[model samples]
Target: MDFWILAIRIIFLVQNTTGIPGNFSLLFYYLIVYQKECILKPTDLILMHQMAANTLIILSAGVPQTMAVWGLKQFLNHLECELILSIQRFGRSMSICTTCLLSIFQAMTISSRKFCWKDHIVKAVKYIGCYISLIWVLYILINFIFCVYALIKMDNKNVTRDFGYCSIIENDKIIEILYAALVMCPEFFFSVLIAWSSGFMIVILYRHKQRVQHTMSTHGSSRNSPEFRATQNILALMSTFLAFYTLSSISRGCIALLYNHSWWLMIVNQFISLSFPSFGPFVLMNHYSNISGHILVWIRNKIHFILF
Candidate 1:
């Protein structure tokens, strides 16, 4: 293999190695260790589910792309190609939906008490599993177009460009446009919802801070206030997710518009697309007190043991 190709494969491997394990650790910590110790909070439940979806996104898209880079592209049969494309679409849609739901849930939690939906929103936390299952069903239906058009590439010299592993073989421009709209509509809608929820949460938090300052009490510490801490974490989480998500979107748009002529564009496109799934777990861990603190303490002990 060429040095540059090897370098690209190594980069993909490193990203998956870091992200997959981190997300699994968080999942185990929340669902197993933390659950055994105490009741899981509603937000933790959302985080746990989102981590599961993130792990799937990495496995379905990142792992296969890495294998393709390592010369496994030609080995994929039509069935495998269709499955990979379908799962990739499913994972992408689910991630967007789950992240949007998380933001909306947090916003609803932090809304002013006078808000009309406040009580109903609080009661709806118990049905998180139902909502998530509905999201999965909706995205699965939307991504069925993947299986319809996905095909394995043949090694014919006459073929000019190969998309590698799997290619969408649709020729009807109208059908292609409709399929693209189906895939993008949910994403665009969810993004708008996330932005509104995050903005609303910020406004509520700002007003609350002003009110607290007017009646400042020595007993109240920002760190000790659960609402304040949760608000900060949600804002941090939203900002990180939106930044990565937007980068991925722009990279994908460019790749599509420019016809993927340059190898560097493909690399940049892949890297940006993988950014959220690969880096999001660590971001969530940073905002999550227990998980971050536990990891830090474990690292400290390992270092102490190593030195002694």
Candidate 2:
């Protein structure tokens, strides 16, 4: 094994191990712990959904990629490959959609009280679950193609394209174009909305900061408001998502266009794709300080009990 391959494998292994637990912990915190004290807000529900999608991504895509890199070849059968890849695609689409939805919701939350859409925002929050369900249905329909195309790897002579443990069956040029358009169009649309919402958030935060500064000088005190802090966290989360998503997309594009069936490129692409899922939980956890504080206290109590 080459030095770089070993290092990449180690990194990939660490990412998958840590990410799964991190997302599960966050999900547990929201569903079990936090809900014991207060009702889950719309944002809380969205964050829970995002964490679930991230976990799915790491499980379906990250773990398989790690296994493939560790020399597990053709371990999955045709049906398994189809199911895993379909789930993986659905997870990725859900991540994109949830992040876009989160950004839009936060932007609306921080909008001025007199904003024209205030009533609509409230109504949207009330029906957020419906919107989330709608997204799930739409993406399932859009990515149904993956179920049709994903196949177990065959001999090199029979394989038109390879994805390490799985292969996509060859199709007509028009079908290929249509598949690409179907996958890329929704992702591109969500990406654009994320960018727009992030920009709107930056503007809102800037105005709020200016107002706070002016008031602070008169009152001789300065403190960040909860909305401001939450908005900052959301911006950070959105920026991280966009950065990782862009890098992963570019790497995947390179592999598709320049290096057909290049194993190293595939490994690199998988690593980049897992970056956001692996790291996003920490960014989100920052927004909920109480959750982390409670977790720390629980850990401390456990240690104390063990020592005594």
Candidate 3:
């Protein structure tokens, strides 16, 4: 039974690793090369970095877990395990980095028009220095020490007892509260921000939809046309982020409420941590018409070229 479950997980891990880059590759082909007007904007680069980061995360974090659960103990104790552990730590740090990027990206996107930071983010061609700096310092100080320990003691089955993630849960509830604030407070605020932004855009879109309907007095307006589609696609990305974040957050909160180190419970919680990263690519790709088109075309061509 465990083997079958492990098999399923391995399949999923491969699909996600393959599928995400596949999405990114298609995006790159269309977005960078094919689309004549598609300038390599800062957001584009952010997303490119994000895709690369996720690939690294999966390579490091996802694969090792699969190996462990599949009971590949030899692989677990071997050099591969150490590499996996190190890469996993790297990925965790990068995950925090990407997360802050997502939050800051959306926060700046939804910042009040009068906020002074708005222009800074907009003109932040080089970097968003303050936010980036704070995030880097916080992540390193928290994760760096424990990460080294995790690498050192990775192969030992006692690691679950040896190392606690970020020391967030075990040592101090107050600390957990603070970390959760650092994470979910921003998440909550940004959830509201994205919702507000989407709502504002929706009003504009609805009016346009109505205006088009009234003017043409038939099918809906060109609001549903490609540009509007892209707008809604961005909205969906926001929604997906919020949804997965909210769910994981709820699970995290539940853990805090009753975190007694139940093995099965912790197992579930560990799995819960996965959804935001694993499901993210599909969430991003599934909604966007433009990226989806590239993926579909790429797959079709690959199939045809191979078959022929």
Error of 1 at 286 (Å): 1.3
Clashing pairs in 2: none
* TM-score of every model versus the real structure: 0.82, 0.88, 0.60
Error of 2 at 123 (Å): 0.7
Candidates ranked, most accurate by TM-score first: 2, 1, 3
- Top candidate when judged by TM-score against the true structure: 2
Best by lDDT: 2
TM for candidate 3 is 0.60
Model 2 lDDT tens row, 1-308: 69987898799899998899889888877775554667677877898899999999999999988888778877887677778878888999899999999999998888856488788887988899999999989888866755654332222234355677766555456555876787778798999999999999998888888989998999998899787898898899999999999999898789767835567777878888899999999887777767767677767877999999
Q: Candidate 1, which segments miss by more than 4 Å at Cα?
A: 1-7, 33-39, 149-171, 212-224, 292-308
Clashing residue pairs found in predicted model 1: none
Candidate 1's residue-wise lDDT over 92-209, tens digit each?
Answer: 7877888898898888777746578766786777788788888878777766654654332222223333445554343345545766788787688899898899898888878888
* Regions of candidate 3 where Cα sits further than 4 Å from its true position: 1-20, 23-39, 73-142, 145-188, 218-227, 259-264, 267-272, 287-308
Backbone clash count, each prediction separately: 0, 0, 0
CA displacement after TM-score superposition, residue 79 of candidate 1 (Å): 2.1
